[model samples]
Target: MTYVSVQTQIYSPQGWDLSDIYKSFDEPKFEQDLTGLQQKVAEFQHHYRGQVSQLTPEEMARCLQQLEVLSEQYSYLDTFANLVFCANTRSSEAKQFFNDTKLALTRIYNQLLFFNLELQDLDTTQFDELQASSALQQYNHYLNRIAQFRPHRLPEEAERTRNRDMLTGRFAFVQLYSVHRGEQDYEPVATPDDKQVETPAQLEALLFHSDGDVRYEAYCSLHQEMERHNGLYGFILNAICQDHRIESQMRGYPSTFHKQLLAADVPESVFRLIMDGVSDRIDLFQRYYQLKGQAIGQKIRTCDLNTPWTADDPLLKLDYKTGVQTLLNALKPFDVFYANRASDFFSKRWVDTKVRPGKASGVFSFPTFAKHSYLSLCYTEDYHSLFTLAHQVGRGLQFSRTRDRQTYFNTQPPLLLREVASIFNKLLLFDYLLKEAADDPLRKQAVLTRMLEDQFNLLFYQSTISRLELALHERAAQGSFDHSFVNEQWLEFYRQLCGDAVEVLPEHQYDWAGMSHIFTQPFSSYQYAAASIVSLACYQQYQAVGKDFIPSYFDFLAAGSSMNPVEALRQTVGVDLEDPATVNGAFYYVEGLIDQLQAML
Candidate 1:
């Protein structure tokens, strides 16, 4: 089996232009906005404080509109500072500006905190009347979302104290972890031609290197560096977990997971069902690994899990331009609007694809309420990089639509639905590749293998991490634990997930320390798994309905947080996250792919 790389003039990817947001921290507009936001917050506090419940429906609508404007102003400042810092984590100027912006926002948030508390305390009749009022119809969904948090609402003073404390608590530690990780360097992989892999994204790219030895060395290099700061990373994660647990207890939430569920407006039973469904499908995950091992003619190891099955063949590398074109072409057939939205990310330079010193690792599409979203990734010129671009572009496109269609309050989607567009784009790319292969058996097999491996990763690997997080929170609830405890728990979960299909290397225990989500966004892994399931179901619908599915899919992305995620899914894609059939169907789809791969073998 052989494949041709996408041929184009190879050019170094460009950094995103932040000028659209603000030319720099020194920009007059940036400073003006910062001052303007503080003034807005103060005005809002003065006008709405302690009077939210007493306002007529018309007045309430006006207050809500004012709050939305204030939020957009604050997010604009915060997003700029954070994006600049992310582009250069080592810059003291950037870090200081980011911290300063956060401090200012924190103060503003404290002043505005009373508004939400007051609204949460609104009497039922008034709240219902406001929802029914013509003037407040646009904000009815926003009001309902706030109402859901009433039971968890702390006293005004307590909530204000907590908001202020987060600057030095959870948020501070997360920033530390991000900075520390950005600074660590990994030993160069000699087998990979003496390449120095500094950023985590570079090291991760090496995991998919065609050479098994290169993959192993890269894996060791990553974990060894993480192991060096195991204590620090562990402490950060523990502190985060402890913080969440404490907050949950104080808020009268039953558990940390329960709090996450409430924030997503998802039921605990739904999350549990997804977790249990993935757990029950461990055999399918193991089978895929075993098949990969057989295909490569060697027993799989933790490092080799990402190794290309066609190890002896030269890897297919696509330049940034070609990658963008490939994604555009794939998406054009589905919907021109989506394709055009994705193209804007590249043509408009909204993506930072350059790998350089002090830049953060990992890929992300960050959407701003006041401006277009920005994406960042270390593009390595491989198929993986191409797919990652599609994934992030999917997110950018989804958010772009929401920003255009929904208000600032409804712009961000729930965690469970957040990954749907991204995963759906990946599937679209997969189908395009498979179609391009046509009658070429080897090409079809390669595409099938990559898609299957990704599914296994999203479903099983992510679920395993989610389980480890659950265990960590439970331990944190019991008492204090150190880095060693985290390492042990990670190893246990890894072994349980891998079974005998792959050898669990010693360094694998420290792998969890390298995962940013565990430190920054706990329980987010479950969302990845849940989104994968929902995405597969959506993909199946797309396959069944062809072009008819495109509009509804777009609607799903545009829905944002305006409605319950469960209802949104049911309405847009007809996917019911609570249905066992949906979970089973996703697994069955994976099984069919596996069978196809096995037949090819």
Candidate 2:
């Protein structure tokens, strides 16, 4: 079940093809689509405004069909504008055009939201009758999900006013943070030989450099900028958290974290189970860090987490082509369809792999919804970027296929479900690399080390952050929130999770303001951690059953929204997330990797 190498390793920097989305911003078709969108909005408001609740099932079905089409149109326009602007944040035209496009789209959204607003207002008898209608068979799950949020829906006037204010409220701060940080010049204190100043992604790449000095310099430079603007970022964090608190209070949610769990479509019981299960076994994490610290004769500080512990090798410096080949080969064991789909991403220019100025620092899978997904990464000649490519492509492949098979309404799942493909891909690739590493000790050590590091990051780091987020939100809910309070909570969580082997100080406390999740996106960290743990359980199942599990895995992914995630996992992997034992599965997986690394060392 191994793939033949597509070609020998080759190196070349290539850009993604945006033509599949649009030729350019000035393309006539984009303008025509925009005009059509305006007309459709007006028509919907004209026809379905007051009588939405009384529409026949057949007419409701027609409206649903029309809504899907309009959604696809909005997806295209929004994705295109975002991709264009992210490619060059410095471009004045791009900046202005992106802002304008967002405004237009928002207006359309406000105009058409009345349909769903009224639709969701249907009483139980009305909703039951509508659900029993044959025409709504395909939209059953979507409508049911909309109904599920009945408890959280605000009054129309309150919601509309909040929505109107949000454009200039939280979003304004988010945009300011992005542009303000993006516009700063990174003057590398260590690498003076380089011709031009490096982007944040490039400097981050250096943090993984084999040289300790380079890693230290990059780490210091990154925090210096972050610390310089800590107050503004802290203010943004406070404002966002306060706003979320107010919403939760108005919605009758017990806590902000409770609201987050609902949004993720998971029960609060499972969330607490996962968080507690991880923290209860922090002893293993502490032991791993302690032994590693002893081996390297250095304390495992937060800054040094990304630094390479073992000796450097040529395998670490994989050019983009070789990295692509590795990822393609790694995915082969899944089956030809899965592997070929991934390979096509490389062949079809679906990835933007170059690290250039003004491009965003992180990696992401652009959600084009109906058309296809595109990947963006600031790749350096390192396997970190390669793993990132594999991760993003995994998500892209899933999104592209899911959209093709699903209605527009069901194309995107909750955060937990959406992350499954990407995390599972990385786990598969890691297993493949581990098996391949048997031929070389250095490679084996590096792969094992990387796996352990991922456990720290995905499991421990995320869990700690999520726990701290709970405290932050709760304190804000009680009206005792402040910048100093934020710092104290952060450092306390750091102490709890990092163990005695790692140092935590006041300096590390302020970095919470820099984390985009707690600031811009509240309570999303636990989902990332959950995805990692669930993927580990999934991979372990594959190890137990061999290739027979592939069909079930594929079926689980293809289930789309037909099955709830809890049911999907129960059917496919035989693990119940509500049970605390699932975290033990992740623990078992990591412990085995730790034993191997210790034996090698």
RMSD of model 2, in Å?
A: 2.6
Residue 408 C-alpha lDDT in model 2: 84
Candidate 2 lDDT, 1-601, residue by residue in tens: 4544444333665677888889998899988999999998799789888887888888899999989898888989989998888787778888888888888888888887787788888888888888889998878877887888788888777777777777778777777776676676776655545533357887777766766667667766777777777777777777777877887888888888888777777887778888888888788788888877787678877666766766464346778777888887788777666887777666777778877777755666777765678888878878888778878887887776666667888776776766778888988888899899889988888887777887678888888889888888877887746677777788888888776888664468777755767766778888877888888888888888889988777766665675567886788667678777787888888888888788988
Candidate 1 local Cα displacement, residue 389, angstroms = 0.8
Of candidate 2, the 10-residue stretch with the lowest lDDT total is 1-10
lDDT of each: 0.85, 0.77
RMSD values for the candidates in order, in angstroms, are 3.5, 2.6
Residue 460, candidate 1: C-alpha displacement in angstroms = 0.6
Error of 2 at 471 (Å): 2.0
Clashes of 1: 0
| Model 2 misplaced stretches (Cα beyond 4 Å) | 1-10, 191-197, 313-315, 480-482
